[model samples]
Target: MVIDRRSVQRAALVVLPLVLFVAARAVSAVGDGPLQNGNFEDSPDQSQMSGSVVAGEHAISGWKTSGHIELVCSGQKQGDMVLTVPDGAQALRLGAGASIEQQISGLTQGSYYSLTFAASRTCSQDETLSVTAAPAPSGAGSPAPAQTGELPMQTVYTSIGWDSYSWAFRAEGAGLMSVVITHNCGQEEDPACGPIVDAFAIKALHDQPPDQAAADNNMLRNGGFEEGPYIPPGSPWGVLVPPVDEDPVSPLPGWKVMAYKKSVRYVDSAHFAVPRGARAVELVSGVEAALLQEVDTTVEGSWYRLEFSAGDAANGCASSSDGSSSSGMKLKAYAGTSETTVDIDFRGAGGSNRGKIEFRAAASPTRVVFVSLGYHTKSDNSGTLCGPVVDDVSLVPIPPPYARRLLL
Candidate 1:
């Protein structure tokens, strides 16, 4: 029998590539990065588009879109209004009931992840976006329940008319998981008027072990505001930690945003002046923007000292609309029954001042809260909200020899 060597060699070439592709897919992990076509830059071809509305399910690369999904270009006009793209030259506008989903592979089971995206309302005064994470089916009994949250777009926190939001969800029993963004509603007059969204990204979140950073005499973890969500490049506005976020899955680990209607800005040194580290929290909405943390005191009823830095972010936070420089900022720190206010008359020179608060722990886990006192906006742009920066937070119990008696 004669064996054809050419046939055998040709079959080997085809089979080998398939085997290697499967092997690579099995080991690849999707963690802490942007999704494919996250900025919606890979638009649909002319055949896949019906004017601005996407016509097919797989029209957008790396995504399955439904309903009235429109691909919008920057500066695209509707009548006399210009549509602004948050990032890149193209963005997605989901009409009423429209949704876009992408299936991600290689997510670890039961690991929490933060989803960050940029969004803005187009014509509706009251519009909302629904984010859902659905776990892929495992061979086990049943799939995990889908985690979903509604983000309101009624409030415009930034001067640019758009903001970045962070939401947390756990990766459940999955080989592949779907991350979805849906538009809940639009204007009554025009159902196509919805939200423009871009810059989708994710970051794996982890809680620090007990006393992990205690060696530096700081009882709180991530007190320097370094460990948090991933801030995309060129995002000067920073990420917003909403009040609905809890400590367990908060993008800002170890700290919870307590404001009900407003969100605290997570600024980085690349765009703003951070006090002690690359990152810090800006109390932009005055008292409406606050940070809270429950820290474990080594000894109950012990004396503890809370020290932090406060100053203007120097992102034009001091100048008034009338071209006058007025940089008076106030921060209030509260721990148990003790409270202290720190005042910094920042001149926008890019530095911070320290504030200290010593108090007695009323319980094992004492609650520490920080809030801004006055509402402020940037001097260069009055429409932009700006505030004082808080960083280098530290809390430690006072030693017995150095402890002092309180008169109050």
Candidate 2:
């Protein structure tokens, strides 16, 4: 008829923590609801023609469209050819000077929100899309104040197919905000001439200390070069042969090919050996075939570390004496205005080589560039070009010594 007080205390210690953890998770899930129909899968009106959503009417249930907008479904007609939705069964076809707007609620003031989406060119050779979010109008009866601190406009070129993009902005002084996606392409006679948008999403970033957030979040997008608009015939792998020119602005999704001289091979573990992930970029085109990415830094004036793996492709195409092939590759890394170069030589074929660089961000946004500077000369007179392989690239902000001690 007696109870053990120690046993009761032990049960309480375990049960109390479990209950608290479950409650915390439930609260987090409630806050994770979608801000809009980001995938554009809901189409109440089965219409494909332009201006299907009448003026002052909601398009696709949760969005309001201005000017001309079409809810394009798969297998729909766009002028003379059939149009296919990129992300889902349905997508928004924005006409020239057209826009789609939605109001996001339940946001925390002074918190940061990240917006992401997929966009592609539909009718034109190239298209630019701008996304803006600001505090909602004060009231239905009162005039709204001037808006400030809009995110930078993003331009997407469609030749590479559908590309994914992300941007972050801070919410100031309001719990509600309005998000607008506008097509900024020039006017054309065809109604289908605009950008195709799909899979839009907005999420509030977790409340973490500045230094911790920087350390946890990667500043570079697609640093591994895994996400690209197109998947080559050797899926997850693509080859960019010599004389194939690519724009330096955006050679692939979230990457730029700065100086492509010969051929560069995109390798994936699925098709070929890779240093990390499903894909890695190989310098098969010889020297000057470089890749770079520019990303906004959350922590300015703070030291950040660049880490990556480099090695030779060992494809037996590189030229060398004694009938053996060697990959003599050099990598040049630039962080903002400061620059450094490292020579990479594979001790043997497919040897593991690692490299690291540390730099401070001098500005709010920083440019991190990697260029190939070495080429292998041919001995067999095959005229084939070969160079080093680079993969698993990452840039992470380094916390100060004092902060590290505090965390420990």
Candidate 3:
């Protein structure tokens, strides 16, 4: 075959562009950010013992310690309990006053980034972890540091083992940014009582403001009850056995518990089946306990759908049919002024069912409430206190009339 040099050059030109395009896509998928050694697999020295890294030390590549931070290896421990790393072979342990930070350059100004990581409690009690991203320190000639919004601090409990968490933030001015993860637990005699963090990752989100993103997406926070307060030992949920006259506060985040009378409210996980996530909330002790939240609709007169999973908490609690006092349990959900109720039979305990309701937003902010009715009888003669389990609650705004017409 006779080969033409000019024809060969033209074919090479066509294939070169395709190769470059694929390479560019591969680079983008890997992400260009400052987070390095996110899995904690890279250490200056891979030691089996729990090693302490002080502030200004470079024990972990691309990360700096702010106080006395410990590098915990998998299956290592400081006390009687063995510390299990959430991901990879190593994890960073933050005590009462320790923190770890990483600074990355080349961020676009006004862009959004979603930070995610896994956290687990090292001690038997609960601990709080705070993570933030801000403008890195710059020279005098550099642009002034951009104002950064505070991310909500996460309170992790012992019941939540190796759970992943996420926070979104925006870059004020795109120069260099620093991401810091700190332990905010109170001082205690045992320094090992804190949160162990691993598997850190950051991805560039849209350019929209964080508040706008949240409002446009889902108006409900912790709707799945995954972010419930710490559950104690031997209890399925965060058990609040208040006096018969005093109302106990809701242990789940972003939800309020209003009991008409003193009763027990359970932030459930680990004991019963949860419809979604690792936890669910149950109203166990009171005659009625209501879980309520005020969700911002962002647009008045807008149609929104409220969806949730409900079931009876069958933690061996005897139902009314079990020959105990009072009728069986029920779940009442109120979106704005519209209400829907589901009867929970003791025979159907531990079974999850889905329910939803649509309502028009009369006001910009709408009230969503879920109430538990009836009393639960104890299987062990501990008295009736069972309630319905509520999980996977979500509120999504429906399109306006004009938008619906356009879609049609």
Candidate 4:
């Protein structure tokens, strides 16, 4: 059958402008889109953002990693964006996925995500900023419906977070990627991060590499991460920052305990109590904070120092023991340079086995102390795993060592 030319011409006129208008709008929207419009994390899958880097008309994208990333949008900072391959898959379920994490001193706050995903044109967030996948699924709190006969969606339901932004990463795959913008929730949840999405991206996290000077130290016989050569004053000495789960214990000045990085159960509780009346002196920190404070009998000399000092130059020693004996013993000490030929051995006289010890001194030589105790024991250092027990420390002076001066 022959078609009428005039009818076709008339139809074209009606359809042409609508098509042109739609195309123009899309171009304009791309020009003014958010950079980080995506629901992806900082791992592989960054290039899937809705408004990724564009070159003229095409967008430049790449897989993401656990590093720095950025995203931006133009026209408006509101509305949902697509930033992944358009497909017929559902959103990933977040059992307990973390989107953001804020850590301060000894506190942490963030979200744990375990979301179920679905295929949709857009995503959204309520006024409250609780992110929600658009086209709410049949199940109130379930992932979206999977696409009809498509490549199995790459599912990622992991517990991860970033120091900034919403989370540590964003990702979506086998679908036209998209992201609903949100803001940082100042540890709790930043209202300012909302109202409208600022910039969304998969690359919003980064960690600086280790320093070069200390790079070789990793292989040297010196110290491991946190454990190292005697960190002196004026230097960023190594110290263990207790984990949130740990409950640090404190005892009398003379009381001590024993512990190691590999083992913790022993030091978690005080074995030998430093009774309520035990002489507790305010010894300097960093120098003597031994978990096991006892006398060493292995090395010909029986004298050792109290286990705690804030300074490293106060020639001292710290140790812990079952009692005071060093042979076939359990002791740890933080010993500083004897400096002098005559060792002012700080001894764990009270107990027969020195269970722990810590030695430290101020950067200045004279500041280091060796509170030597004239304790004796038949034990030796043959089987002693002796060292010091401590964490990041600072110094404070007391009566005898404080050298106080009246201030105006």
Candidate 5:
């Protein structure tokens, strides 16, 4: 058969973005704003980081810096100060100011980087700051290739206190880095004397391939399970009705009776419903309960809970009772879409005790109800109904029919 060229091209077009996503690691880093760091070396105290702004005086602060940064002011327009990160993380970010001075060493033999300043106060609409490393390029003497990305943050003049701003920056070329955070405080300050600067940290992302960069933001300090899936805070629970019933169960309720015989028995009958999106059904047995026999759905038109007795634990298909539980009753769950009719079977082994057998459906029915808790002897004598015991039966909605429930 001849293959269609257009089809192949379309498929490639769909997959091209995914292929390029492999380079997601090629992003830039950020540093605490100048309000906290005068020279990025030590950690800045967010509390002590505060101070009032004078009309023309720029109050800057920052910590965890290997470089220097300046601050910004409101009410007037000013230039910026470019921060320099000599080597590893050119740990440098700016507040409100203009590029004033930059001194980076070892760049002639390696790479270098710098950070741009954030917007000033009164620019409430401005959310974050941006920084880029202008590559002194062409020759091999370029310190490291500068990272090209934006820091998604902003901290201008607030009504009362100050908001902290910081980001992480990275350099590839191994050399001394130069950085300067440009700042321009408003030329007009009224009564405030302290513009607070918050604290920040520089935890290294792994030295592994850059592809893991985004995921690195969420890795645990101890290295365990991956970050959460960001499920909604209010995602609701599931819905299942008409529980299973069994004789000789533990903790007998006022509504149901105990098992009549030790040889084989069933439950007091139950009324249950299967909400949309259920996945699997459960059948619990006592130690005495034999392998599930004839564990089939309810004869109530649509399918219901599975039925099992002491005798039918063998092949969980349809089988006749052989008098002895050795050949105990054998039943099966009809795996099919009420409309699709896909045949699936459940056994004593497939979730016989704690596990569940899968079931499927086609339409998004409002409910696939069931009558849970109907079974027989777990064994000849083992799981006999003595004291209050427990037996369960639940309807498992397979894929298409699967949906979660929401609480009011």
Candidate 6:
């Protein structure tokens, strides 16, 4: 055994690289962008299921389930209600402490990633869903801290029962990461009560810091609503960005949803009539829904003009058969301490009207906020709240001459 030490060393060197190469290929094979079987359309085997309840942790394809998890079919009847699946023909219902998770690979360390999923409450109005992401079990170091966010499902922002929501977190480590969605509702009387979840997808968010260079003179980043989380294909209802206070990192960069219980709907041109670019934010929650951004100004107390486009997403909000909405939409724009309201009359189709407001900065970084003034619903009588779409936001300093004249 003591002979040929040099041969042994050479063998070790050759085998090490081969092992590393194979390991790298295995990691890349997972294809980190899309979550496998995210829509829950892949049904479990009959042996693994007792009726709709899945028995084992590995029963669901491409996922690990725990506690009481059930596969729900679209239009499944329960008493007088029919369950609606948000994506595809099937969805998952987590009961009590139950959760479903899958490990995603190809993540870049220190980069931000956002999870976009469609969910709706069931059984009780107080139902909430908790989403958490942490580095997968590894022998290296202690692993990064887990990021979690509890979403309140009491508010339904779409005509359908389900709404697509986005949650963001920063990846502290590369390699594989585990993403789990659990039902937070702990109703002992009915352990089956939980939220229906579907359409799980993730998007890597590019850095769009407030001070980042803009495409135009607009001080705000992503002002055109071009950069955002991935929208599940064919999702007519846009993704809802939860309040900034709850999620801190928004899927829609450079902007924050102000209300704790409200969200701003991020719509696409394919789904909703976007005013500008390929995307826009629809203020669907009336006054509860507000978007805010802070941008640096040239000088403190200097006048600045906040210009933006506001219009209907052409979602049939209060529409009449004659081709026009019955009511107009109003948006209140706030620049620093001063504010102004803009009213855009609906003209049946999707279109935008330009509006501007001049206000003193009061400080170098002024807070810009947009709040929908009135409540609106689709003309089809779906009872879904719909409102004006805001896009192409720009803030620039006003010349002294124009400022003085406007002041007078």
- Best by the TM-score measure: 1
Candidate maximizing lDDT: 1
Prediction 5 global C-alpha lDDT: 0.26
lDDT digits (tens) for residues 1-408 of candidate 3: 999999999999999999998886654343533257887788666343243544346667778776667777888866677777866688888877678888766667665555656677666444556656777766556665333222222322223345544455566544467877877775466765577888776656432244754864767876766543234334443433222122112234456655443333445556776677677776654344567787764467677888998876666554552465655567788998778887666563567778888877777678898876565555555443456788888888777774465345
Q: Write the per-residue lDDT of candidate 1 for residues 1-408, one digit (tens) a residue.
A: 999999999999999999999997764567677878899898688899999889989999989999988899999997888888999899998988899998887777877788899998887777888888888776789888788877777778787878998888788876478889999895556768788999999888776555667568778878888878878878889998887643356778888888656888888899998888688999887877689888875467688898999877878777443344555778899887789899877666577889998877877678889998877777666478777888989898888666755523
Q: Candidates ranked by lDDT, best first?
A: 1, 6, 3, 2, 5, 4
Q: Residue by residue across 1-408, what tens digits does model 6's lDDT show?
A: 567989989999999999999998875554324578888888888899999999978988899999888899999976888989987899998898889999887777777788899898777777788889898878878988898887778888766788988988776676578898888884546888788888888888875455555545667778888888888777788888888675567788788888867788888999888878898999888888789998864478688888999887887875332345447778889888888888777743678888788887778778899998877777777777788889988887788998999778
List, residue by residue over 263-309, the lDDT tens digit for candidate 4: 11111112211212211121212222223222222222122233222
How do the residues 161-245 of candidate 5 rate in per-residue lDDT, one tens digit apiece? 2222222234344333434333333332422211222222222222223355334331111111011011111212111011113
Error of 4 at 151 (Å): 38
lDDT of candidate 1 vs native?
A: 0.82
Cα lDDT for residue 280, candidate 5: 20
TM-score for all models, in order of appearance: 0.89, 0.52, 0.53, 0.17, 0.24, 0.88
Q: Model-by-model lDDT, in order?
A: 0.82, 0.59, 0.62, 0.23, 0.26, 0.81
Q: lDDT of model 4 at residue 152?
A: 14
Give the clashing pairs for model 6.
Answer: none
Clashes of 6: 0
Comparing candidate 4 with candidate 5, which one achieves the higher lDDT? 5
lDDT of 1 at 339: 91
Count backbone clashes in candidate 2. Answer: 1
Which pairs clash in model 3? 237-267, 263-286, 264-285, 264-286, 376-384, 376-385, 376-386, 377-384
What TM-score quantifies how close candidate 2 is to the native fold?
A: 0.52
